[model samples]
Target: MAIAKFAGGWAFNSKAMVADAWHSIADLASDILTLATVSVSLKPPSERFPLGFGKIESLGSLGVSSMLLIGGCYMGWESAITLYAHFDPESAHHILEHIGHGHSHSHSHSAADLGIPSLHAAWLAGGTILIKEWLYHATMKVARERKSSVLASNAVHHRVDSLTGIVTLAAILGANALESAAWLDPVGGLLISIMVINAGFGNTVASLYELVDQSIDKEVKSSIRKQAQKALANIRDGHEAEVRDVSGVKSGQNYLVDLELAVPGSWTIDGVKDLEDTVRTQLAAKVRGVRRVRVRFLSRDAPDDKKYAEFIPGSPGALPEEEGSSKQNDELVDGHSDKHKH
Candidate 1:
């Protein structure tokens, strides 16, 4: 699509079509970003990095969105230059004179002379429009199925490309039909440029927000809290305690929940384990994209300044109890050696 549009655009000397071509090229970059991010983010957690590689997807999106913004700005600038040339004969003559063309007169051509678009370019524009729209719908469907924000954003980018193609096609046919109104071609290009820039800016902002770990919806967090409280209450019968806190953060396409639980100090280790497990299970079942849940148990009788006992699945126990036991064993060995020496 990019090659066809670019070649046909130059052949027809249509600024709008060329802008649409550049938009197609930007879409190609977005596709590459989507592929790269999906591949990297699928890796499991490793020894060095325990959270997995989920943030790579957000970073990739940031880079891709930046590219889109730059491309959009460049296209807008080019279209502006073209519009200036179309409106001011003196500017056109200056450009031609610099190019050392045979005829460098200011009044050599008028706006009416540049208005009409060729038949071949118009046909190419129509084909591009159809292709882009089809791609937009297909991509959107897959994005929805996977519940991927990056993919959904790319799908919207494709729709913008298709819209640009539509604008180009209309301007080409309209200008060609209205012989005396040759300025419509550049005007259409300007309009498409603005649309492209706006889309790019919006995408960039969203990607940045994700990269900075922006909070999710209040209602979604509230729902998670409610489900967690209900699940905990069911599991901890007869215990006079309540949930301390329930917080969730977005990690790429999924969520990580930090659930603070308060339970009776008399409960055994096994009982606390069961509580954590039950809360995690309930959250995973109810929440749409909860990837990991870290449950922290606080003793009901312990001081408020005391730390929570964190229970995260998959991490080996490096708890304070194990450290205290190691210290006690060392002291016992030292005392036995001292008694033998005495």
Candidate 2:
């Protein structure tokens, strides 16, 4: 589709069609990137990376973001130049010649390069709209069936493409039909470029946040805490298990959950282990997007336990040594030290 649109746009000298073609090219590149990134990102954790390879998805998204930003900026600049030339053909040639340093050959040869958009270009835009719309619905259907956020996001991307294609089709048809409205094609190109730029910028920020290990939303944390609380309720009542904290960062659609559980000091190590397993299993079963669960148990009565005393065993706050016993021990140590003195 990208190739066909690009060739048709260039042959018919339609700026809007060519800009939309570049958008299609970005989609093609993203599809190729998704193929590799998804495969790697889906791999189970290994000893080398206990958290798995989910960050690969962010890398792929970043790559696509960069491509869109670069391509869209270039298209916007070119379209702006074309739009300017449509208003003042002579003035544009002067500006291009000046930018080209008065060289005989210039990047653009006046407004004539854009030419009159042909009906063929309008046909190409209409076809692109149809194809992209079809792709959007089909991908969305599959995404729903698989419950895959990745596929759903891709479906949304296709929807944007189709909508942009609608604009491209309208602009091309308007330019083809109205002799005085030739600037509409370039205007369409500029609008499409803005959309691409906005998409790229938004995706770039999201990927950056993911890379920085931003925590999941509060709603998810609340859900996790609620689940943990429910799991503990099912355990023995005297254990007094309570959720202390629920926190973690997201990687793609899946996330790792860090669960802090507070239990009575009387609970045995084996009991804590069982609780951990129970919470892990229950969350994995009941939660829709939890990838891993790390459970930490802290004794609720630890502050009152001898093991958690504020003072060390020999500290001043602890039991004091007998004063005479300490002095006699010091004299005995002095005598022994004199005998071994060097």
Best by lDDT: 2
lDDT of 1 by residue, 100-200 (tens): 65364433344533556676888998887788789889988998998766678777777878888889988888777886656778788788778777867
Clashes of each: 1, 0
Model 1 steric clash total: 1
For residues 1-342, write the lDDT of model 2, one tens digit per residue. Answer: 888888987888888888988888888878888888988887899999989888888888899988999999989987997898877867776776778735563445445665668888877888878888899999999999988778888888888889888888888888878878888989999999999899888988888999899988898998888777788788776248878777898876678898777788787888788888888888987777798999777788764234324455565677678999999999999999999995
For model 1, what is the alpha-carbon lDDT of residue 262?
A: 77
In lDDT terms, how accurate is model 1? Answer: 0.76
Ten-residue stretch with the least lDDT total in model 1: 104-113
Candidate 2 runs further than 4 Å off: 97-111, 302-342
Candidate 2's C-alpha lDDT? 0.83
